[model samples]
Target: MGWIKNAKAATLGEDARKAWDAGSPVFTPILNMPSSNAGLSGRVEDWEHMMAAVLAIGWRLHTWAVCSDSRGRPQAQPLFVRP
Candidate 1:
C-alpha cells in the first residue's frame, strides 16, 4: 500500500490557504482573492490549484469536518494530525 496519509501531508500553497482561511458562511465553500491574484482568474485551472492544496493537506473536497479562520486557513486540520 502507499502512504496516502504521508503523501497528503505535504506542502499546501499560499493562495488556497488564504482563500480557505477567509472561511465560509458556516456551510458554504470559501474562496476569494479577486480576479487579479496570480491564479485568481475565475477559471477552472485556478480552482484545480486550490484543490491540490486542500487535498495535499488531507482535507476532503466537501466532506472534511474541519474549520479554520481566514487568517490561517492552510494550517493543517487536526484529524490526521498527531499530538
Candidate 2:
C-alpha cells in the first residue's frame, strides 16, 4: 500500500495536492526505481503471522451473528460453542 502511494507520488511529481485529489488511485505493480525495495532480507511475508501464532497457542476464532431486536436494538449471538 505504501509502495502504491510512492508510485503515485512519483507519477504525479511535486504536486501532492493533485495526487490527494485523485482519491485512492489504482496502481499496478511494476519494477520502478522509486518503489524498488532492493537489498532487503528476512522480511516477514505473511500478514497472518500473528493470527497464526495466536491460534497455535490454543486460541480460537469465533463467529458471531448480529441481529436487530423488536426495539431496533442490536444483539450479538455466538454461532458456535467453542471448547
Candidate 3:
C-alpha cells in the first residue's frame, strides 16, 4: 500500500513536468525577442514551435468546458467526472 501510493504520486509529478516542458518551446523564442515575435518581425520557425505546443495541449483542453468573457478569464464549468 505504501509503495503504491508513492508510485501514484511520482506519476502525477512526472506528468505535470512533461506538460510544463511542453510549453517551453512555444515560450522561449517569444521570451528572448518579444518585440520581434509579433507580426512586424515574426519568424516562421518560432510560429511552428508555438503551433506544435498548441496542438499538443489542444486535446487536453477538450476535457473541460471553458467559457470566457470579453476579458478572456475562463469561467469554470464542470464537464464530467469518471468513476
Candidate number achieving the greatest lDDT relative to the actual structure: 1
lDDT of 2 by residue, 8-55 (tens): 444433232343345423211111222132333333222123223323
How many clashes (backbone atoms < 3 Å, residues ≥3 apart in a chain or on different chains) does model 1 have? 2
Worst 10 residues of 3 by lDDT: 25-34
What is candidate 3's lDDT per residue for 47-78, written digit by digit as tens? 33333443443323224343554554433332
TM-score of each: 0.30, 0.24, 0.29
What's the number of clashes in each of the models? 2, 0, 0
Q: Model 2: residues >4 Å from true position, as ranges?
A: 1-61
**CA lDDT of each candidate?**
0.38, 0.34, 0.35
**Residue pairs whose backbone atoms clash in candidate 2:** none
In terms of lDDT, which candidate is stronger, 1 or 2?
1
In model 1, how large is the Cα lDDT of residue 24?
A: 28
Order the candidate numbers by TM-score, best to worst. Answer: 1, 3, 2
